[model samples]
Target: MVWTLPEPMLAEPVNNPALPPGFAAEPKWDGYRALLARYADGRVVIRSRRGTDMTAAFPEITRAAASLPAGVEFAMDGELIVWEGGRVAFERLQGRLNRTAAGAAGMAAQWPAHYVAFDLLRRNGTDPDLTAQPYTARRTALEELFTDQALAPPWTLCPSTTDPTTAAEWLEWSAVGMEGLVLKNLRGTYRPATRAWRKYRVAHTADAIIGAVSRSLTDPATLLLGRYDPTGRLRYTGRSTVLPRPLATTLPARLSPAGEEHPWTGRTFSATWGAKAALTVVLVVPELVVEVRADVSRDSAGRWRHPVKPVRLRDDLAPADVPLFGDDTTTSLT
Candidate 1:
């Protein structure tokens, strides 16, 4: 029987990324979840999490697979990433996805991609299925495979640790694009698309001054948030996700209009760039501060990769207490 692309094993949230004595921790990379396999004839196939056949879409990666350790002619699981400028650039991957064979070669030279492998699923061209093997046994084989190959560029051996302390260290290293941490039970067996494996995603929190409100000030949908620079300029940081009804209803009474001195007095704010969904704001006094939960992927202008959600009303926080990024957390969430 021919081997098919098995569903990637999934992760459930745990408060901590650390594992028990028999478990192990691996750095969760911020990139596409990919399953890769190579043939006896040096042909390779790649598949995305959604099951898209990407063999022709990543020619360079196929070539690199051909160069993997001898006798490693089989299927494996890994994360495909574009590492650049000392960090994994998720945005850079857009250039390589959905491209033809001709286009892939050009993009490969411009923004090369690498596979950070951590799991072994099959050996020798789809024979000897390793899915039923204990994680400990399979992990041992995975490491030995990398050592045998003297793995280099476009083929990275993912770092794994049995020490919780080391996992905590990687969680705080999101500045370099560490997605989070993955914890696997040593005795667990590989079960595709299952939550037998646990994952802890990194989330950061900061205070945002509520500088503006949505169209329905009396019961607004979202809050326009900003932070002050060293020069005390209230620059637009980003917007918040929908506010709870109770909070939204009471916001109008607390906000006062900015007559003329507002920095965003005449500026337009779009919820998303090039997106038809635009929002107009009524600049208010930048007096109220709210706590927001966000991820590390930020825009060139320092806004978050996505709209942040308000953690809660921050009556204890002041504008001075609002931080401007540069904080790391070890906490994990689903």
Candidate 2:
């Protein structure tokens, strides 16, 4: 029976690093989540989490998939990453996305992508659907296929370990662009779009200046944060998630309207990257510093890619105490 790829399975956030018994932990790669499939007719497809066809945008991955041995039809779940400066460079991988075929080919020569397969969806036309099978059985099949096919280069088998010590050790791989860990139950089945897996990403707290805010100053929703670069430009670092009721009440007291010289005076902020909706930003004096807990994930410009969790107002800290825009978290987020 021919197997078709399903929507990507999602993972729920987890805080503990301890790997539970009967669960296998894999280092969460800091890159785009993709599903790859090769058909009996020699057709190859690479798709994104949102069901976008990304085959043309990543010629290197497409070429690798097309090169699989005859009759090796399979579908696999994995990440698309690029290695640069001795580590995974997610910004480099972003260069290949949403490009013309020719443009992608050129970028591929400079920053080729690698597919890190972590889950096997199906093996071949004759094999029964693997999504219903337990993770252990599918994982074993995936390993055997890798060994038998002698996959190399663009193809990578993600490391999985059931040992708690090994899983904890993988967390340190954050230095090399690993986000953290995805712990999967051995007896679990692949349920697309379901939070059947647990994810633990590296998180840290840092200080940022409140340059603007969403909603009225008296009842703000989120704080737009910024940090000065070496050139003394207050670059937008990231924004906070919706404030807790108690925290929301405390901010208006400390915040004041921005002066004429505010860095973001004429600028408009988007609700999200590439989003069309503009945020209702109320520019504030860039003096109030706040502590925020953020994941290791960042954008090409060192801005936090996800909304940071506001810990508290760091009244003791000056705007200068925050890390420079180009100083911290040199990575990219999903």
Best-fitting candidate, scored by TM-score = 2
The reply for model 2, stretches above 4 Å from the true place, is 92-97, 125-128, 329-334
lDDT by residue (1-334, candidate 2, tens digit) is: 5557899999999778789989999999888999999886778999999998888898888888787777778889999988887667777866466678888999999988999999998886455579999999989989988998899988999999998888888877766667889999999999999999999888877788899999888989999999999999999988899998889987899889988899898898889854669988999889998888888767557777779988899878888887888576422222
Clashes of each: 0, 0
RMSD to the true structure for each prediction, in A, is 4.1, 3.1
Single out the weakest 10-residue window by summed lDDT for candidate 2.
325-334
Residues 1-334, candidate 1: write the lDDT tens digits.
Answer: 4567688888888776556888889988878789998865676889998898887777778888887655566678998888777877776676466677788898888888998899988775334688999988788888877776677778888888898788778877777887688899888999998988888777777678898888765667888888877677888877888887777767778888777888888888876633546677778888898878876665434666567777777889888888653233323342
TM-score of 1: 0.79
TM-score of 2: 0.90
**Scored by CA lDDT, what does every candidate get?**
0.78, 0.85
Candidate 2 residue 44 Cα shift, in angstroms, is 0.7
- The most accurate candidate by lDDT is 2
